[model samples]
Target: MRLAPVSLSLVESVLAKPVLDEKGMILVGAGVKLSERMITRLKQLGVSSLYIEDKRTDDIVIVDAVSDETRRSAVNTVYNSMLSMIETERGARRASRPQIGREISRVFQDILADLKANNSGLINLASIFTVDGYLYHHSVNVAILSTALGLAKGYGQKEITEIGVGALLHDIGCTKVPQEILNKPGRYSDLEYELMKKHAEWGYEMLREQDGVSLLSAHIAYQHHERNDGSGYPRGLKGDEIHEYSKIVGMCDVYEALTSKRFHREAFLPHEALEFILGGGTALFDLSLVRLFAKNVAVYPIGMTVKLNTDETAVVVSLNPEYPQRPVVRLLTDEYGRRLDSPYDIDLTKELTMMIVSYNE
Candidate 1:
């Protein structure tokens, strides 16, 4: 199967992966052949891409770093926790804040276990989701990405759990912000922007009051926006003033936000998002964390199409864990744009002369 943009062309194609809801339930299951109506609905739901069945790439498989069960549980946990917090704030019901913290921590352990058992040692968060589910999915993605970075840095289990929990709840403060501002499709006015920026302090206050949440973890919510050069919000902490855990989560948060399709703009491809992160190294974010992120993330995810500098087109077959920028690709077309009768695979790390020029063809 291969990843393709959602369009009329997918009318007769079968879905290779399931499209999930905010609750982590499968809205459309795999192996379901799509109709024009289904495709139209997907586009309306803000789905920009889909993994469709293709005999040519039948052997290609895209693996998630975490298991399906774990992912479902994580999303559900985040959704419930955030909703409960929001309701509590509105005086709708009394919520056990400590219990919320404990529940999130438990789910983080499951996510950590899955990441450790994953042999690929690379992160792929190209899951299909609806726009309404963005916050729930984004929380889980950030946690997974941050945990991957922690493992790459050789952090112990305790440290990993701390950072993982912190990452999972980094945006908890946003629950306090008005729904209009949070879901605004365009730029924010100055007053709206100021209100938005207060989420960090709000989140810190909430998390710090939870019995199960650590002070260090609460600080992650507080300082995740703090820049390495003292340009970030809430506090102008520079250099070593920002906690290392916050630095890790901050980078992952930016990368996840960029790669996700939004109301205002199309999602940036993995490679394009990486360039943005690289460009901000040492200025907007910690340089060391940015380098660590670029190393572990799959710039060109499996089953993604690319046009090589050789004027050939190929599908990424697998990741070269040590060099994510260079993946193993299976050629699909020659320079002349003719389909090849016999497609062949090449490892970009070995073929140094060839490079990917464009993707999503």
Candidate 2:
């Protein structure tokens, strides 16, 4: 399907792609026949829409940064580990350190292999979001982006693995925060905000105590909130005082947050989010990492309908790695809203006079 807003009755014709739960477990999978019962179950879980591989866009594969299995597996591991850390903070017994570390390493390996396999380097995470699975999904996105950045920075495999695992476990301390505070739909008051900022240090201390966990890995949790110009939270360390891994994860962390949907406000479009981050520049993030990040992400993803400045409407057909703002698109209609007899593809990079004006839907 081309991501149309189909009703429940229309849902019967399409298959259910893998739908993940809050804990990152598969709630539904591809090729499964859809039924009224399944649709009802999905609605009960707060899922209002889903991706299907229907004939309309069957050829338009949404290339994943990692496999569905890999992404879900990583999400599940992070969710479970975060919950365990919360339990421990509440007086429960500590779990095996070696086991947790091993799981982190294993996830890193799987993610690393897939990242290398993806030619575009740019990752599209919009394909896998769940309304209630924001925390775990955010973890997976951050890890993916951080790993790609490390790869771009010429980090060795071992170092990249460390960065990946560190980014994955960066928000474990959020589990200790009050659920209401965590899910607050509006800005936090001064006292609530101060408590919220404590998560970074809490996460670092928790990770540092674990056997087999790397000190640098724990530092990622500690220092990810610190900014390049000393404007960030917890310990307000500036510039080189922030660890390299922390800087990378921090940049990814902010980008993910900006692009993600929240109850209080709508999520920014990818290009819009990038512009916001670019505004921060070296003041809020490492400038070099910011530039590299812009390269390795899709501003306008495949399958999105957009209006062009030349008075035409089209669907994004292909991504241009060198020019993310200009992708190959298939013309759907003319400026007068008349259907075309034969829709043709235009490489926006070559057609320099035309530009995307707005999202059609």
Could you tally the backbone clashes for each prediction? Answer: 0, 1
Model 2, 209-243: lDDT tens per residue?
88767899999999999999999988789999999
Per-residue CA lDDT of model 1 for 286-331, tens digit only, reads: 8878888888898999998889999999999998988888999999
What TM-score against the true fold does each predicted structure earn? Answer: 0.95, 0.89
Q: Candidate 2: where is the Cα deviation over 4 Å? A: 1-16, 31-56, 92-96, 336-341
Residue 356 in model 2: lDDT: 92
- Give the TM-score comparing model 2 with the true structure, all chains together: 0.89
Best by lDDT: 1
- Compared with the true structure, all predictions reach lDDT values of 0.89, 0.80
How far is 211's C-alpha from truth in model 1 (Å)? 1.9
